[model samples]
Target: MLKKIGIKDPEKQMLKLMESGAVPYRGVKQKDVRNALEERFEPQVLKSMTDEASLAKRYPGVPHEEAAYREMRRLTDELNSSDKGNLVEDWYERMYAQRRAGSSNRPESRQHQKVSAAEWNKNRPASEQIKKDRFIDRVDSVNIGGKEKPALHEIKSTKGKLQERDKEQFEDMMKVAKAERNGVEARGADGRMQKVDQVVYTLTDPRGVAKNEDWIVDQLTKYRNNLSFEVFDAQGKRMMIDARSLKRSKDGELVLPDGIRNRLGLK
Candidate 1:
């Protein structure tokens, strides 16, 4: 009867259906067979089936273990092809880099393991820790004093949209910053000149960045502030000018901000 219904491995399929607890009676009516086939053939349903990890527990060793391993590898491959996967990969690289740099002073026993920022603070005295309402410190590597230190092993669900983007823009911005560190020539349009600690380039997105220009600039500004880097000017450089400093003169032409005027000691 099972073969008449087109079941290739009627005996095996019957055993599986019975094991699944979906079929009770050994008599096995046509509707029951049809229901099993319908459930098995649905792709969406199959994709959402119990994960291979759970399968490993039910069917331990040999073929089940091999199948579970292959499924895990396949799922990992699929994840690595997506935006989130790229972020996770980059974060792991950063964590490894920090660990290799010896930036963390954690004990020998804990050195090898990855500890989340939240977990790191869990048992510490309140005076020794900063209370974080959310897990922003869960970044793979966080800036500790002036050194970059790895803080967490596992990627928490708390990371927001910022992790989804590439850090290429930040890298390119750092090149301009390096020049500031070397020495920037601040030449004004009116033939004025001065040099400062670091030049902030405005209206510019770093290499490979073509979208969200304004938001990226704002984020860069915020990042610079957090890094304790002072904003500076290039002689007559508008890109380095603060938005607040950009104002309309009596003639309606764009003029430098009041801060710039004060910096230049102008009225």
Candidate 2:
């Protein structure tokens, strides 16, 4: 019957048909089995199944068909929902602007910071100076001296409250910032060595809950002194006043304060 219907391999078609009907314990319906077989026998789908089977033979431990279906579904969903445009726009608006607007002297609104291995530690003993280079955390922004002192800005956006790892990361960053303030030079994107005068860490919560912000501020305060915090709504509206300035709104949803707004040039 399969050969009459133009199925190229009647024996394999019979195997599939028998497998589809083997689940009688679950009260399988004849129509369901027929639908399944009809889909499996479609020319393109059947060819894909054959290709997957061939690959399974070539590579032992690979599942026959279910794995292919799962991978195909995952790729399809990812392609459908990817935000490549938004990501590009964000990189341009945030990172590119910072890199191009070198130093705070440029009229651009943002600044950039890069940290690399300190220029080949010559003063240290030969054994200490030739240590293997390791990667440290990267700061989102670093503004070196204009109206305000040079500072490192680490921005984190979280849906919920900050985690333990976040606190530990802040501590490690503080060490780097302190070293920079103490005449330690860090290589920037332009390849010039620069030192930071201060450290400013910023945390942004997208959920914008008053309680969440309060808890985060408390946790950070106990962990370290002199950290900045910002909260924004789901729509990206500023929700909390600058914590550094020690101001709080009645409803916990306030625009950026005058000092910070003027410094950041935000409306």
Q: Which sections of candidate 1 miss by over 4 Å?
A: 1-133, 137-210, 227-267
Cα lDDT tens digits, model 2, 1-267, are 235324598667656667676423146687666545544544443233235564365435655433332322222222222232222223233323445455544322333443333653435434333233323223333333223333455544333455766556555445555442234344454445566433554433333233254555454444334344544333223433334444455767433345544443334
Top lDDT: which candidate number? 2
- TM-scores for all candidates? 0.22, 0.38
Alpha-carbon shift of residue 38 in model 1 (angstroms): 26
On TM-score, the candidate that comes out on top is 2
- State the lDDT of candidate 1 residue by residue for 206-265, as single tens digits: 111223333444554454432221121222121233333356769975554556455433
User: Could you give me the TM-score of model 1 versus the true structure?
Assistant: 0.22
Model 2, stretches more than 4 Å misplaced?
A: 1-96, 99-146, 180-194, 208-212, 219-226, 238-243, 247-267
What do the candidate models score in CA lDDT, each in turn?
0.35, 0.41
lDDT for position 185 in model 2: 48
For candidate 2, report its TM-score.
0.38
